[model samples]
Target: MRRNTGVFIAFAIVFCWFALLTFLLQFPTVFTEPWPYILLLLQTHLYTGLFITAHDAMHGVAAPGNIKLNTVIGFVCALLFAFNWYPRLLPKHHQHHHFVATEKDPDYHGGNFWAWYLSFLKQYITWPQMLAMALTFNILTYFFPLENVVLYWMLPAVLATFQLFYFGTYQPHKGEHNAENKHRSTTLKRNHVWAFISCYFFGYHYEHHDKPFLPWWKLYQEKDRSFK
Candidate 1:
């Protein structure tokens, strides 16, 4: 219970924030004001939170006490964020870690930004994901305001993918993952606040690859203690 507090807190924040943001978007003139734009960013952050929590679950830290509980939370998070399938992501993520920056690593496609991003997407995105998203969008538009569903629900998830890809994958694993950098990953300069806001401390990513057991929330401390 003590060990599991952070995961539960992170889970609640993302789940509750997503719902709360959706509820707030139901008001009149919401789009006309700057509130919607701010909310979009907040929602996007939560979407990233969803994926981060899921990634933690992949490493067996989300609910360290119970394996079943951990998997369920991860599955729900992935599904809620973008209809992403957790089972599919699990193997691919481990494979990326095993292979690092080589061609065997599904997430690494080298220095070219768009090419790497497209390769990254190809490994995760599926026809089922697209179909499920399309179905959800259509179903949501019938009961909720179309703008609310699109802006708060859909757009944020899309942006969150780019957020995860950029800070978590591309930045850390970019450039040469040579012999000196055995982990084949990079660590950002010390900025705990910026690290959390950017990608949930995943920017301190060399610490992550080095100490895979540490949860996302703990990576910054690892960064400070070991790296610099």
Candidate 2:
């Protein structure tokens, strides 16, 4: 229970920070020459956090025992990404865990990185969602500078898709796996800081597959043993 509360508070803080940054970036004066690009990089990580949070909820680790709250949090975080379908993702993710790297896994892509990413996007992105995101962007652009909207909100979300796919799915599941091992995943051997910055230690895919309940933030602590 304490862990769940801590996870909730941490997520709230990071998400609120992202929102505040987005709101502030709308003022043209705030984004001077390089600052805008710098913030975009930071925003990308924060946006990735939103997806990671929703992913945690799918595993029942974000707000344990409270299905309604978990669903609400997951739904909202996913919508913020403009490409998520959390309810649908829950079952699909479970299937990935059950039949990882096999044809039965929704995330399996035969180790083709680009193909895997596009296939991942195809699962959730639909015309209705695209139209809704476009409408929302158009409406928000009326109040915020179009550049600000694109840089801070839109680009970060897009970059985060790659970030999540690369760190969470591709690198881990790529290459050959021994058929004897049920969990077909590999771990990165980089130091903890790089691992955290890269994908919040998701490169420690073996530990994640072994213990999916530990929220992503905590994955960093178990890095040394997990990595090759």
Candidate 3:
């Protein structure tokens, strides 16, 4: 099947799943006790899926010759989590793709297990200039009152989740010579399954790295092709 076709199939499945979950959340009996927490978690998970889809769009992996469409999709997806719609960040993310596994890459893996663990914190907190970012997030949340959650709280939380997800997947594939490489290689069996089910198969990072232009659904096909 074509990459785009696969992506559409994957997207349809994910959308349906989220829709079902949302429907279930509306029933007090279905969600049972602690409905608020359940709803929040479900919403956050759905938002993460949207965020990954937006990332794909930003990379032009979701659409062709339609930059505006990609921008609009990405911006709308970010808004679901109360994030800023900064088009400039797309270029920086693209740059990471170019350098993939190297230290010279700002997004490199950068150390051993412990080091990488610590680095994840730094990536999510420090590099973004946490205090200033927190203030900005707060300001944004204060202005927007979607989902009853303060905009500031939601923005930072969602952005932090994205950062952690990115680092967890990217770091494993980074080069040994890279500043963040504490190990020669990393495994993704656990993460991949969870990401596939939770983050809309975005944990298939190795496959994505191999065929950057291929849509998400065809990512697995590309992985299979390498063995063939």
Identify the leading candidate in terms of lDDT. 1
TM-score of each: 0.94, 0.89, 0.60
- What stretches of model 1 exceed 4 Å from their correct place? none
After superposition, the stretches of candidate 3 with alpha carbons farther than 4 Å from their true spots are 1-37, 109-156, 159-171, 174-187, 190-195, 226-228
lDDT of each: 0.85, 0.79, 0.53
Best by TM-score: 1
Report the C-alpha lDDT of model 2 over 5-56, residue by residue, as the tens digit.
8366546846675676666556574554777777788888888878888888
Each candidate structure's count of clashing pairs: 0, 0, 7
Could you tell which candidate, 1 or 2, scores higher by TM-score? Answer: 1
Model 3 worst lDDT run, 10 consecutive residues: 144-153
Q: Write one digit per residue (lDDT tens) for candidate 3, span 46-110.
A: 55666566677777765555677656666655544334344644775676677655565555555
Model 2 residue 20 CA deviation (Å) reads 3.2
- The positional error of residue 227 in candidate 1, measured at the CA in angstroms, is 4.5
Ranking by lDDT: 1, 2, 3
